[model samples]
Target: MAAQAKRIIEDAVVRKDAKVGDKLLDKAFALAFKGLVYAQIWEDPVVDMEGLEIGPDTRLMCIASGSCNALSYLTAGPAQVTAVDLNRAHVALGQLKITAIRHLPNYERFHRFFAHADHKENAQVYRTMIAPHLDAESRKYWEKRDIRGRRRISYFTRGLYRKGLLGNFIGLAHLFAKLYKIDLSKVLEAETLEEQREVFERELAPVFDKKFVRWLTSQPASLFGLGIPPAQFEHLAGDERMAEVLRRRLEKLACDFEIKDNYFAWQAFARGYDRSESAPLPPYLQRANWETMRERVDRIDVVNANMVHWIGDQAEASLDRFVLLDAQDWMNNAQLDDLWGRITRASRPGARVLFRTAAEPSLLPGCLDDAILSKWRYLEEQSADLTRRDRSSIYGGVHLYELA
Candidate 1:
């Protein structure tokens, strides 16, 4: 068992070898992203907020991925936001944005900071304008010299935020498709609705029909790059009928979307998006919302630790909402219980939690049901709406809960 276990849990012990780790990147499906943040665009959280019937005074806590939606919450003008994550890299990503918005003279500068992130000049600007705002840890992470011996700040010299973890995984999946002789990237560049229709009809549809794609779709390990753990894969889609459900979901992703309006579709087809002032923007990107953003920016807080430890620091009934992004898939029962228990303890009378999953079903009901899990009401209809509208066509499921 010990030797078998060694093979099972070696991911953490192994240092990243681009040569070897390249093969294993998507195996973990860990969530990592940076710019043009699109987590759940179509879900329109504001609409969901309306459904939650939360008040203007509501203070919420959520995982700050790409910080887009978390910053989007500021548009609702929530009183406070406490963002938590175990990934120092992600926390670094969030802190970087919050600091940039406040310090970078204007939106163009701001855009440049992230848009042309692969540049060196951005580092100098960061060291001068943004670095002072960051904590020592983040400053260290960004300031640490890159392989070029140029500081990591050099990455921003041109201010383009490149393909991050999620972006990279999406790219890797594309390469895998190519290695396997499939091409999803070309689908994104379809110039017109007619072109897109043709591509989907020809190239995209075959991925679902092919034997290898079908086999890969059926395997739990293959979904890791999308952040589905083996347990979560089993819990969500591990059933005997999983292949059918997965096929249905993938089909929906390929065909159930309108290329023009669907941002998730765009991300799937193109690794990135075409940004414009009038474009369908995310909550965090809307310029008019910045004043409200500025006022509430100070209200947002972050913890450079795992959620369990962070939740421990909150007092009973101290929080109003929670956003645990697909991270629950990575946790076991005891960890889940500790987290939910703390969340339960810290929640107010009508607190709500927003979460996503790699599979259709949620990870909570088994442990957090009505009798034992009676403290929360799963907002199923609202969750469905969010899932349907989610601009980041990444996850298979979305869920919402109101504390009982």
Candidate 2:
């Protein structure tokens, strides 16, 4: 099944390279990520935490996932930001966020544009207000028709949250429940919060405990779609029952954060974050002083490039913050060397580099010899506390590092 999924992806994406921009392997990487895990369903608050060092002089680089985090970063006064992504869909989404924040008449329209993403009026609003600002490539990407022959932005029209990888996976799980004589759709239809909690506990909880289901989860290959590589699978199970580990993670994803406050958790369970006039905070959800954040926004420049390729393109010691989002797992040592080389060059004194991975520690240790990596201060221990508190604690760790 993994092999088949890979082939399907290669034909549809890697070979087509339909979403490839800036031609960094990240298009390839994005496809790979999509094949293994869901992309762009919700913003991970951890990424926002990793990227946010908001101040007048701060500049940051982060993955453009649906653009929510990008604007959330805008709330912080940073000199400039360079949002990058290989997925054209995500780029279009990010471009839309940038456009909406700058052009939407006020917070109300902006709220409607996103929080209530399914409104049919959004397409018109997007065309009139947000679409014009998008770069040609990104514009075309979102405007293009999907397999269902619907405009891509139509994904926002209904099942707004059901459009991303995680959404699709949950959808599949619901379908799977049908095979087991479970009516997941009915469970999902619980409209009230009390009903949702009751249904999740009573109806959905049994599937995880079935002997057959638990047996299937024992294999690493089964969860590749969730982007659990073999190494990550080991870390996740960690001497506990696979069911228990998932329970712990899901509990973290669902329960650890406040219901109204945690956007990541809301997106995971409720599809969209919130459906009200005033919405919940997004991952990079800060805008403390708009004047300062606006000035900071002006100072940033966004480019399309990957770490290794772009590092090769730059002279040394240039960047203050490097945001890597679990791409290292897809790379080899040479790639790591090149990427770190670029990090080494692009980094300024006191620069802090942040990234997340499937495992509990930095992907840098074995790939980057102690000789070279030693120069960079590992904030692993320092970040451990924050990692414990991350919204997507489904994975193992959130790591922070500072360049010496």
Candidate 3:
């Protein structure tokens, strides 16, 4: 399974004809990505739902990163959600989340297991209550020991949010901040946007100017933990130095939205969701949506496969929505054409497709063949609006398209 997962990722990310340096970078990214990457997906589900117009009739196909958005979409009562990913670890994580929701005793247990993820009882609860209901593959994944000889499921007890590539990347960022005598958590204390801006300018913004920090950020490999491959790194940097681009992105994350309302910010600044009952959380973790998620948990199907291949097998005009989740940033022209071609064929009338890019503009117009691309209408104005509202602040643009 691990070998096949690596092949699938390489097929999607590694360009066969690329130069040696590019090929090496892609290979490195695939290796890093084969294991757990996103402990919690970074995209804002609320913005996703708003952009997709999710409803009871919506049948959505999304890339299952951490399964956060897929599970959250259940709250909107979608008819069905098919989440496909190239990584087996993500598939196992998604399956585990679904099983846990179905078999866990109550909302508190569920809450404690996921939200208060550092609690000591979570692993035991998983073994006793959740494991019995899990499929063998997922069960084996959690039971497996890491290089440190710790069972994978023990992450819940020790701080699940602090594991994975993204988690460790944030931890590393915090370490760098501490090295400069700046406490990143200070941004979390701001009560208003003005205060947030003040905190960012005072405590965060200037760090980008440090010569050592700028040099570190300039290396393409430095962003591997953020799931950025060499190809996407160039797009993210564009004409600016990577340090400036990172500073702008971090500024948005810190000052553009209220810390109390942005769970993405909480994860970035606090390393987990806020513990308060009123703390902002992804839709799947909110108490009001808990019953809905539980009731609709079975509506999702998790598949470990390349999304393009999986979609190719589906009947034409069958899917109503697609959430690509920055996966396109990893693709070359041929792959993009193949993906959009399948997407166009599989899309139902008025079907909406949503995705994010590392750069501000959509990557489609010039890259995808016009014959296939012309069949979909890009919602330029609405896409720009959603981009501004995305609280994650990590992506450059949130794009939406509809079958024309």
Candidate 4:
């Protein structure tokens, strides 16, 4: 089974006859993604849910990253949500979260486990409550020890938010911020948007101008922690300095929304959610939605497979909504067609597909088959509006496409 999973990824590396540089870069990205990557998702679920407009009859399909967004989607009362990922660690995390939601005693306890994310009791909760409910695969994955000889689950008790690839990347950024005498956590304390922008311009924005920061951002490897493949890096860095792009995105994160309620900003800057106001919590972790989420948690089915491969296996027109979170940025033209082909086959009438890109324009025009592309109406205006409102502010564009 593991061999098959590995091959599934191996098979995804198209351009087999490409130049040495491309091949080497592809190999590096595949290796980086093969292991545990995102401990927490980077996308903005508020923007995603708004764009999706999920309802009781919505059958959503998505790439499950850290399981945060999938759980968030449940609040909209979707009839079903199928989350597929190439990473087994990601699938395990999704499954563990679902299990925790179903079995945890209350919303506070749930928050303590994920939001607080470093309580020793979290490991205890896992042993007594969460572990039993996890499948054999997830159980084994969490039980596995790290290089420090601690169980991977111990992250819950030891700052879970600071452990994964993305987490460590943010940690590195914080270290750089400290070097420049800028405290990132200050953004979290700002009471309003103007204050947030003032703090960012005063403290955070200057850090990007440092030579060390600029040099680091210029390297493709520096962004691997953000789960950005080298191919995507090319798009983000095109005709502009990578540091400049990063600074603009950071400005958006720090200034575009009120820091008190934008949990994405809080997480990026402070490494955790706003503990004082439960309203800032992810939808699944919020008090009011916990019971409903708990009831609806069973609707999600986690799968360890490539998106196209998995979607191809489902019945024709089985899915109603597709959340392809920036995965298309990594694909070549042929691969995009393959993915969209399966999507067309698997999508029901009126299905809406939402995806983000590392670059501004949608990836479909020159890549996807025109006939297949014709089946969907690109929601260009709505996507642009949502892209500006995305509090996460890490992506270049957010796109929505509805089946025509």
> Which candidate should be chosen as best, given lDDT against the real structure?
3
Cα lDDT tens digits, model 4, 1-404, are: 66776667666743476788877877776777766788778888888998898889989999998888998899898999999998888998999898898898888888889889889888789999889888999999899987689889998899988888888888988887777788777888788888888898898877778888899899888898888877889888889999999989889888988876688887888887777864477777788888898899889999998888888898998889999999898788888989999989998989899999988899899889998999999999999998998877899999999999
lDDT by residue (tens digit), candidate 1, 1-404: 22332333333212243345433543343322112233222344554455445556787877665666677777676778887754555566778888888887777666556643544567677878999888887788667764457555554653223344345456776776677576776665665656766766676565666677668777756654454555566556655445555545545655555555555565555554446444445556556665666667787876655566678788888878877777777565556777888889888888888877877677787755344367788888888887876645557778888876
lDDT of each: 0.62, 0.60, 0.92, 0.86
Ranking by lDDT: 3, 4, 1, 2
Candidate 2 differs from the real structure by a C-alpha RMSD in angstroms, to one decimal, of 6.5
Worst 10 residues of 4 by lDDT: 6-15
For each of the candidates, the C-alpha root-mean-square deviation to the true structure, in angstroms, is 6.3, 6.5, 0.8, 1.5
Residue 17 error, candidate 2, Å: 22
What is the C-alpha lDDT profile of model 3 across 1-404, one tens digit per residue? Answer: 77787888998888788899889988999889888999899899998999999888889999999999999988888999999999888889999889989998788998888887889988789879999999999889889998789999999999999999999999999999999999788899889999999999999999999999999999989999999988899899999999999888899999999998999899999999999879998999888987888889889999999899989999998999999999898888888999999998898999999999999999999999999999999999999999999999988999999999
**Which whole-number lDDT from 0 to 100 does residue 154 have in model 1?**
59
lDDT of 4 at 365: 95
Give the runs in model 2 whose Cα sits over 4 Å from its true position: 1-52, 174-206, 215-244, 276-279, 283-302
lDDT of 2 by residue, 84-200 (tens): 654445555666666566676665566566665788888888888878776786677678777689887776667556766556766666566777776544433455556645665
Q: Residue 127 lDDT in model 2?
A: 88
In model 4, where do residues sit more than 4 Å from their true spots?
1-3, 13-17
What's the TM for model 4? 0.96
Per-prediction TM-score to the true structure, in the order listed = 0.78, 0.78, 0.99, 0.96
Cα shift from native, residue 28, model 1 (Å):
7.2
